[model samples]
Target: MSDSSTAAEQTYRVVRNDEEQFSIWWAGRALPDGWYPEGTEGSRDECLARIAEVWTDMRPLSLRRRMEEATAG
Candidate 1:
């Protein structure tokens, strides 16, 4: 989808196996549309990497303090 906040309905929920491995998906929620890796399944690293990339691309946090402290006196 568009580069915007992650809505519950548009985020790709990473479901991990009992052993904490990337197993299943709860897509269309934790991510926007068309955000995924090609032929990358059962790969924890890849899944997390994609998640981080997507989250960062969305500016997940609003750290105003960190954003202005250096410039603010």
Candidate 2:
């Protein structure tokens, strides 16, 4: 196998937090507390791209909820 092919085959997983933030995690590693898989697995670049597409809101979930409550009240 070539070096490029090996690099391309490098595995990654997409994980999300309670705030809905997205991150790429190395495959074959245990997920940290408070993070869960987003059901995506691929190359590192691919996982990052998937995160970019889905994680549009940068705000944490609690902050967003507070903002919404304030606006509503």
Candidate 3:
């Protein structure tokens, strides 16, 4: 309802899971299980930019490993 509240809502932190999947979570909130902070925090756009820069591999870690194994055999 207020400008400050809206700004707060827009703040986010980049996070990643065990599968190496990248996402954004609200700053100062409890992260979900299996997700850990990547030490970058900012507005939604900033967090997304960080994810874009780091998450070049869209595939999950397990999926990539499986693909590698399939090709190796």
Tell me how far the alpha carbon of residue 21 in candidate 3 is from the true structure, in angstroms, after superposition.
Answer: 0.3
The lDDT, on a scale of 0 to 1, for candidate 2 is 0.91
| CA RMSD of each candidate after superposition | 13.9, 2.3, 2.3
Count of backbone clashes, every candidate in sequence = 9, 0, 0
lDDT of 2 by residue, 1-73 (tens): 9999987888999999998888988888999999999999999898989989998989999999999999999
How are the candidates ranked when ordered by TM-score, highest leading? 3, 2, 1
> What is the full ranking by lDDT, best candidate first?
3, 2, 1
Worst 10 residues of 3 by lDDT: 3-12
* Model 2 regions lying over 4 Å from their true place: 1-8
For candidate 3, give the lDDT.
0.94
- Predicted candidate 1: what Cα RMSD to the true structure? 13.9
> How much is the lDDT of residue 11 in candidate 3?
77
The CA lDDT at 44 in model 1 is: 44
